[model samples]
Target: MTTRAFCLEPEQLDWCARLRTLAAERFRPLAEHGADGRLNRPLLAALGTERGLLDRVFPPDGTAASALDLCLLRESLAHGCTEAETALALQGLGGSPLAQFGTAGQRERWLPGIAGGRTVVGFALSEPGAGSDAAALELAATPDGGGGWRLTGTKTWISNAPYADVYTVFARTGEAAGARGVTAFLVPGDRAGLTGEPLEMLSPHPIGTLRFDEVPVTAADVLGEPGAGFGVAMRTLNLFRPSVGAFAVGMAQSALEAALAHADRRTAFGGRLRDMQSVAHQLAEMATRTEAARLLVHAAAAAYDRGDDGIARRAAMAKLLATETAQYVVDTAVQIHGATALQRGHPLEHLYREVRAPRIYEGATEVQRSIIAKELYR
Candidate 1:
């Protein structure tokens, strides 16, 4: 009998270890040359070819989707090659709406390119005025008096923007207040009136701003129901947000391992650092917290895969705890390793930069807390 490869239980350890090896030995080298947030096409192509990860993101016609597998892949990749992990995650995020709700023709045109890793995809939602408050979005998609709409507005801090071959865009179509007024569209990069420029940000993620100057789109471009796009957006976020926490747990685990190794080897005051009570206790705390965060992430992912009704609160809690724990763990690792950890090329230095952004992106820690509170009261 064949084993279930993507199980949430301990049996998946071998699979996770294999992924870790690939990330460190193969993906990390390619990620090093990614050039500060530009589209790393070559790197993506390589990952797509390795272990068939690309196929999983944009699966074939009838295969079932599995959230647990998605979380497992993200956590394993982030442990060694965070850039590659982020690239894969963004593909899943941008392509998912169409995978779930796009017209038949729309899916036929984009899914193949995405699965082959030959196409870059972007999620265009956040605007200058609607960062955390997504319901306040103002990107206009006015009816063209026929069966289409004219998009006119701007989207900022979009992941994989400008350079992405396609975008899953959310724009305002109805006059209702809050999220009810929104609609989602599938817009190709070559659309005449659409243009964008990259933003210089702290994280080396391919984030930018998009301008839509009356870009024309037809009824065929609509994703799901015209005025119910917020539901589509939220459904996608519910699945991906727990996996974001998985990414954080991976980084925290990596930091904890590095600290443990350093403590066992580096001698201080006539003995190894591990012999010191204070240092030993800190290591214990880091390990304990990392494990706890990982468990929360796993439970959340499993709940999503099971289609559990409580997934929103669980996802928010997982992302909030795991991201905050990663920041603390990585910071503590830097402290434990002394000044050398801050050197430019050090892995810890790279992690120090990478860890802060997840807390803010894909719904900030504050946003996650609010979501949990709302779900609780409901």
Candidate 2:
């Protein structure tokens, strides 16, 4: 496989390095200036206008980007500026359905602003009752007398909620049960009866809950066929799952680099930390596991790009291993660095908080395991 070739092409490596530089030089400053737990509009604008990274995800040609490209972009951005990485990821996640399954009018209406970073979007799939079990969503989309539907329910843990200019919402359209009754809608944030409030989270990125008090949606707002929203959601997830792994790998790589730098400098026992056999071995393990996770992420992304069979299994494996590896890598780095790593503004401290969530969100670690097992049986 291309990913197994032992190294990314020279050009690809250069591209990743360039992206990392941009993340540090451009994105990080914007993130630092923004308030915690709030959507950073300036950072979004920088990604869209300055770097045009969002355009890579939602191309104007109405075609989906290769999963490998998404993976590389995410991993590189995440290596330097996680906030920037997140902003880009959320935009891609929310806009993917529109690019893939939306009507002409829908695409024409929304894609431009999304690409330019003037508009923010949210993926409103998770609810209190049905988060990991997405098909069991209860956001009711009842038929109105005028061929439209009225949405009434709550969406929790939504990224960019309450502030996004638009949302891609999946609701129960009652065509059938469990993965069949769902339908996706393109909801304008300013629409009446739809409101949201931010929730306090461990990570600084924006997240909140949305309340739909009979928000009205027209037939024009529906994405793809009625009752096919589950497929739409799954397709989106398949493309992104590996990239989520890439995000983890980026964080892992960052932590590994930090550990290496710290080990090289911090002296203990009359020598540098890196000089100790125990510390040296720990660094080696962190490097090995991080490399393994990176390989898994790249392989899954390549498989997805090729439309290979067992993509679900591969993606699940990548996400599971990489997220778990990131957690271990970050935690170990903190241990090696000791109490100084726990200081409020320490990079490791920020990473420690950030690392825990990837294992929980976008299909938790347990959920990924279930998916892999199910695919293997199939």
Top TM-score prediction, candidate number: 2
lDDT of 1 by residue, 1-378 (tens): 977643355667887898899999998998888788688988778767545787776678635457778888899999999988998999989999988888788888988778678888888889999988888899999999998999999999998887999999999998587899899999999999999999998777688999999999988999998888898889888888988998998999899999999999999899999999999999999999998888888888888878888899999999999999999999999999999999998999999999999999889999999999999999
* Residue 15 C-alpha lDDT in model 2: 94
Task: Mark the 10 consecutive residues where model 2 has the least summed lDDT.
Answer: 1-10
Show where candidate 1 strays beyond 4 Å: 1-7
Estimate the overall C-alpha local distance difference test score of candidate 2: 0.93
Clash totals for all models, in order? 0, 0
Poorest 10 consecutive residues of model 1 by lDDT? 2-11
Query: What is the RMSD of candidate 1?
Result: 2.8
Q: Quantify all predictions' global Cα lDDT against the true fold.
A: 0.89, 0.93
Candidate 2 local lDDT, 1-378, one digit each (tens): 355574589899999999999999989999999998888999999999777889889876767788988999999999999999999999999999999999998999999999889899999999999999998899999999999999999999999987999999999999998899999999999999999999988878889999999999998999999999999999999999999999999999999999999999999989999999999999999999999999999999988888899999999999999999999999999999999999998999989989999998889999999999999899
Model 1 error, position 6 (Å): 14
Give the TM-score of each candidate: 0.96, 0.98
Model 2 TM-score is 0.98
